[model samples]
Target: MTRTAPHPRTAVVACATYLPSTLRTTAETEERLRVENPTLTLPTGLIRRITGVENVHVAGPEAQASDLAVAAARRALEQSPGEVDLLIFASGSQDLIEPATSHIVSERLGTRCAVFDVKNACNSMLNGMQVADALLAAGQYRRALIVTGEVPSYAVRWRVDSREQFLRSFGGYTMSDGGAAVILEAGEAESPEPSGGRGILGSRFLARSEHWGVGTIPAGGTVNPHSEGGAYFDMDGAALQAAFASVGVGLVAETLASIGYGVDDLDFVALHQVARPYHDRIVEVLGVDPERTLLTVAEHGNLASATLPFQLAEARAAGRVGPGGLVALVGLAAGISLGAMVIRL
Candidate 1:
């Protein structure tokens, strides 16, 4: 059944995900941390205990962020073959700073489509969708591809200096390598038949940029490009939790309400998750039905921007969500951004 809307709309037609072949169990991750710093007396099982992260993907040294993106993009296009007018590489990790990673992805994929990069931490992919949707709505592009390759594992802190340093680097323990791709195409304009809407119905975003300091990979930028100190993940878990607490839980609910929907009306929800505790807290506060949301932190760790699309891809595969089903892509980013994008598939 096709949607019969009065105007053209950007529809998410395909979704796919990929993970690196190398897998590191929580035990191995902890052991590596301790081995690298023999003086480290940090407690064991802390990652599994606190984050429920049993395993995370680790890319080989030869693998690049663009490789992951291309892999996922290939899978998505294979699922729904077509030419793309634009490509957006929405990811936290890049192959290099000289050129946008999208260029690398396009070149690898053998596509010369207009390409660029969009970055906003874990919200990168969502923001890319927002941009694609806007452009499609304005008839500026016929179709766009949004892809992400998150390699937070590469920036993980392997050597713990002290308990305080471990606390600051705790977030890195749950880091994983992941890739995802989404295809967005403008639906045909206007039909008079009874309609069930398709594509992005509504989306809302709110950010407290001041929280940017709460989490960072302090190196490779102007501030610490030449220093080893800037090469690993640095985050204050307490500060990030406090920052999100200050933002409250109204964003998703209010966004849905504005679009005339309630939490129960959603068929499936994909919440950006970094850890089990944070995921549980968000689920409880939002009053979302735990059974209906995709919970992945325990298994895949933090997939970063790929989390939402990875969930979406899994839901579709499992029959939890499908064509004509209503779904919500809710995101919580490190820069303290909260958002929800409602879609009728």
Candidate 2:
């Protein structure tokens, strides 16, 4: 039997995730880095010691971002059989820069639906859903599939020439390669509640683009298109932490408060995870119970745009939240953007 959604307005029908079979442990990753960078004294266990990520998923060398998305999309489609009128490839990773990656995903899925791309660092999936929900509400389409695949492993620096260089690549170590897809159907869902909508209720986002340079994969753009040296990620971990700190938790708190519920009052919350310490700090400051949130980064590493969707799937499997359940999705992306969305599952 096909899994069906109970949401009426821009309701979520199905959500699925795909993790490559290969699991690369932090110890293995450190040894590999040390082996390739003989001149640099890279410390072992520091990755796990600092980030609390025990292992991460690694896609095969032959796998591209599109491949990952396709894998997850297939599962979602199989779970809920229906026509997908629009497809969106939203992620921090891509197979190539020329044609939109959504087209490639559509080709692999054999879907002749309208498609597009939305890339906004780690918040790509959230933004894609935002677009899809709005369009669905406007009657632009009947169903929308939002998919993401992240492959930060490929850009991870193997040849660390110096201690400083290794530090810049540290964030890459906490990243995992995987894919996730979410399906949202447009209709009036049957809800017993007063307002009577099950899908996305409201969303709010705040950004300070000035801090965009704090994190980046400097290649593939017009500025450094031809340089292999510019390919790997270069990030200031301290700066990124501080940037999010300065932005404050007002965005999330306000969003939840606007709906007359504090974060603790909600059944579930999906927060974009990067490192364990950061995750702890976020939940503590937000005053959300640890039991209500998913500490996914430590186990799955940073899934980038696939994170929020992954948490949603986990919640469903655990029976924490389902149809007519209240939930909130929060995102912290590299462009120094913070977003929060309230939803009735």
Candidate 3:
């Protein structure tokens, strides 16, 4: 017996992104690091400048995360400009370990909606979309707002040798300080068919726990114990590349298949920005249209969990994504985790 697919009930209303005003050049990063650790030899240059810092000028980790989140949420709200029913904050990292970041943003935004945080490494934004869709489908809310913010600079490990090794730590350069927000609303359509609102068609996620350590903050976790030493991100570059080629590629193919659409069917694809090499590999593996693949890693680097949604906003603003178009948002990160979804418009 065959089964019928569930209908899409929620569609994205409006979306926007926030990028800090400050800029930190590659030379500046090197100079700043030289003061603390003179042995640093940077990669081809992937560092970016962020705003909201003190006399130091460059944005500190926590400040970058918060500022980006606030700015992006504001932009999204302005785009939609309505009373939001719910607010969800998604991020791989946050401004603080205590006091949920969503609550902080909610208070600042003057929003009285339900507030919370969603996290799953880099796939947090996509996961939040799934949750928002579920709530809207169930009629729990009429409209919901999703916000994602990332500050990779804080977790970056800067003291490494070799340009090859430096390039390995290049996730720092792909690190962007930004945030994104999108408004999700209950579709007016009675059936599952796509409409002007462009309801969510479907989504799939795959994560390999055994490979969670492929990329991680080594000293901060419970087992590693931050008390053992100062905590920092420790990436097994070799392992990550291997996983990207094997598990990462397989997951994208599988999810796209589940949704009954191949990469070619997507009008546009917005993926998590890690490094150009990784992007190239995924594009090659998926066999997607090069023109439709949007990238911001060069300018903004990887904004952790915020990458996908931020890209969505850019594509929408440029008129690359719109009503009746099919878009796929893909996010791949540390857990060897992958997320993808096919949405109409």
Candidate 4:
């Protein structure tokens, strides 16, 4: 016997993004590297050709991850239909190790609501949304604020000894500073169908624990504090690519299928902003129309978890997506986790 689907109870009412004012252009980055390492030689236009990132925003010295998160959250609150009953700070970067950064954001926003943090590297915001959705669906909350601030600029190591070191630092160069927030609220389900309304239709997450070491920050944690060669971001690009090739495409297909939809049913798709090649490959694998998916890596670089919401806000502002559209939010995190959330909006 066929079973009826559960009605969607949470709808994204508003979304906003904040980008730092400081700009770091590819030309400046290359010039600085050349000056520091005179023997270094990179092919002309290689950075732009490979990453497609012309510039990335850098947070000022005074700006912390929580600051950006608060900025974005305030903007979202301004546009929200109702007051926030809960706040979730989801970011890879945190201003402090204790007290949870969400508390700081709530204090800044003057929100007396319950607050907490959810982190999954680049997938933090998506995971936060999933939590909010579940809470709303369970009638535990009426309104929730999901926010992220990614200030990876602080982790970048500008000086490298050799080409291998430089290559290892490439991921840092592609990271930008930014924040994003989305307000989700409980709303009446659409008549006759759950997926017909402006709410999350479904979400799925998959993890490959063995690949957890693919991306990492080698220093600052309790396990390896003050260790040498552990101050900056490092990644295994080849391994990450292989993981995506082997399972990424299949995961996305499975997610869409679970929601009773396919890539073609998506009016817009927002994926993590890694680089040009990864973006292209994801679009190809999903069989999605390139024009329907938004690409911000070229301009904003990788904002970590903030990338998805930033792209969603930008797409809404550009009139590329609107009411009643079906959108898909996809994420690939450093923990070697993959997730997809289908939303009807």
* Per-residue C-alpha lDDT of model 4 across residues 186-302, encoded as one tens digit per residue: 877664453556788878898887888878887767867665775688887778778766775577778778757788888899988689888998888789899999888998788
Q: Which portions of model 3 show Cα errors greater than 4 Å?
A: 1-8, 30-36, 39-64, 159-170, 190-197, 219-221, 224-228
**What local lDDT does model 1 show for residue 298?**
86
lDDT of 3 by residue, 1-345 (tens): 654444646888787877766666656665665555566653433243321111111255448465777788888777778898888888887767667788888888899889889988888888999899999988899999988777766655566655555555545534556678888998765443332236787777777788887677655456865436444566767788787667745556666676566777788998876666667767887788878988677556567777788787788889987878888888887887888777786
Q: Which 10-residue window of candidate 2 scores lowest in summed lDDT?
A: 189-198
Among all windows of ten consecutive residues in candidate 4, which has the lowest summed lDDT? Answer: 188-197
Model 1 has a clash total of 1
Q: Model 4: residues >4 Å from true position, as ranges?
A: 1-6, 191-194, 226-230
- Each model's RMSD to truth, in Å? 3.0, 4.6, 4.7, 1.8
CA lDDT of each prediction against the hidden true structure: 0.88, 0.88, 0.72, 0.86
- Per-prediction TM-score: 0.95, 0.94, 0.85, 0.95
Report residue 213 deviation for candidate 3 (angstroms): 1.4
Q: Write the per-residue lDDT of candidate 1 for residues 1-345, one digit (tens) a residue.
A: 765447555789899999998888999988888789888886888779988889998888878999899999999999889999999999989999879999999999988789999999999999999999999889888989999998887788777778898889989888889999999999875433322368887888999999999999888888887856658888999999999989987888877887678899999999999888888988999888999898898888899999999999999999998898889999888987887898889
Off by over 4 Å in 1: 1-7, 190-196
Alpha-carbon lDDT of model 2: 0.88
| Number of colliding residue pairs in each model | 1, 3, 5, 2
- What is candidate 2's lDDT per residue for 225-269, written digit by digit as tens? 885675898999999999999988788888877656677668898
In model 1, which range of ten residues has the least summed lDDT?
A: 188-197
